[model samples]
Target: MSGDGVFSSGVLSCLAALQRLMDGNPTVAQHVGLHRAKITAGIVSVEAGFDRGYLKKSRPAHLPILAKIEAARRSSVSSSISSTSSDVKRLKGKLRLLEDELATVLTQRDKVLTQNIQLWERVRELESAHRNSNAPELTTLT
Candidate 1:
């Protein structure tokens, strides 16, 4: 096939079908028997009304289409990686905030516990002093 005539009706349709698949078009997804994440040359060809063997033959005419498909696949993979990285960063930030909050709550709890202990000690001492004062005076009969 001549370079100018490389994009026949079948090739054009295949490219269109690939774009639709990548864009998550539900109808195309159903026709191709695969979703965007699972797009392959065979599925694209089939969706374009070509047999699976059309792309498998690796004709020079198919180079451009194959290149486009590979590029799309690489783009999708990189985007997925970047999105996952962003998600990890967001989760790490949330975890740090929660850790800081937990530390603050623990400090407040320790302070409250110490105060309670001091108050209980003071109460016990006051009770002892009151008991001693109320005791009968010692008898000093000469």
Candidate 2:
């Protein structure tokens, strides 16, 4: 059966999906089913022709439609994987840049804090010197 002009199971499964779609249409379901039967009959007729030597060929035709579909699916999956990898790399680079920016801002904050502390200490020293210079002077009793 595999070597004959019969469709693979996968092709039949696809046809079943189409049948499900047709079943949902209440008005045209019967007509669609009839149409599908007619199409199946046509395919069988063609297969019979090929079998009876009505159609001569050097080699039998191999309709690997399902295999082709699977290959396309695999190609799409690989493409999406590569796209996701690039997106991750881009996000990591942005994160690194943000971290560097944060470090620079923190360094600037520490420098400003140090300068403020030094300025406050100088003010205290000046006040202490002023108070010491304003003390009462000792006078000579002659």
Candidate 3:
């Protein structure tokens, strides 16, 4: 019974170490942990009725699967971030173009306002000339 307890503790320690190694990938780590639990259960069954050779043969298959799963997740995240970056750059370009168009419109508006002021000044001068021409003249009897 003591030997069995020691063996189980050793297996738990190994599982904890593997879990730590997979900290960067939580989802994959969870899957790996579940797989390890299943493997541990199978080892118990083997100790009860099967051989050690079977355990040795089955051990190497799942590590490669975990690595592949982690790689696919990394690629997916990489593509998403890159696409978002491109979208941000495109939006910034559009904003700059809008700013430039606003400046051009403001310049045109200033020119129109200047021309309107000049026209108003000309109208005022014409009114003043007409008023002077129509003034009554006083003549003295001689």
Give the candidate number with the greatest TM-score: 1
Residue 33's lDDT in candidate 3: 35
Query: Candidate 2: misplaced stretches above 4 Å?
Result: 1-63, 135-142
Query: How well does model 2 score by local distance difference test?
Result: 0.50
Query: Looking at candidate 2, what is the lDDT of residue 45?
Result: 24
Give the Cα-based TM-score of candidate 1 against the true structure: 0.71
lDDT by residue for model 2 (1-142), tens: 1555254443454334334433432222333333222323223223333232222123233234323334444665677789899999999999999999999999999999999999999989976876789766557799
Q: Which ten residues in a row have the lowest lDDT in candidate 2?
A: 50-59
lDDT of each: 0.77, 0.50, 0.52
User: What is the C-alpha lDDT profile of model 3 across 1-142, one tens digit per residue?
Assistant: 1345753554443444334333432223333334222333333223323332322324453344335435545665677688789999999999999999999999999999999999999989977886789766656799
TM-score for each of the candidates: 0.71, 0.45, 0.44
- How many Å off is the CA of 106 in candidate 2? 2.1
Candidate 1, residue 108: Cα displacement in angstroms equals 1.2
Sort order, lDDT high to low: 1, 3, 2
Better of 2 and 3 by TM-score: 2
Ten consecutive residues with minimal summed lDDT in candidate 3? 36-45
Kindly indicate the candidate among 1 and 3 with the higher lDDT.
1
Q: Could you tally the backbone clashes for each prediction?
A: 0, 0, 0
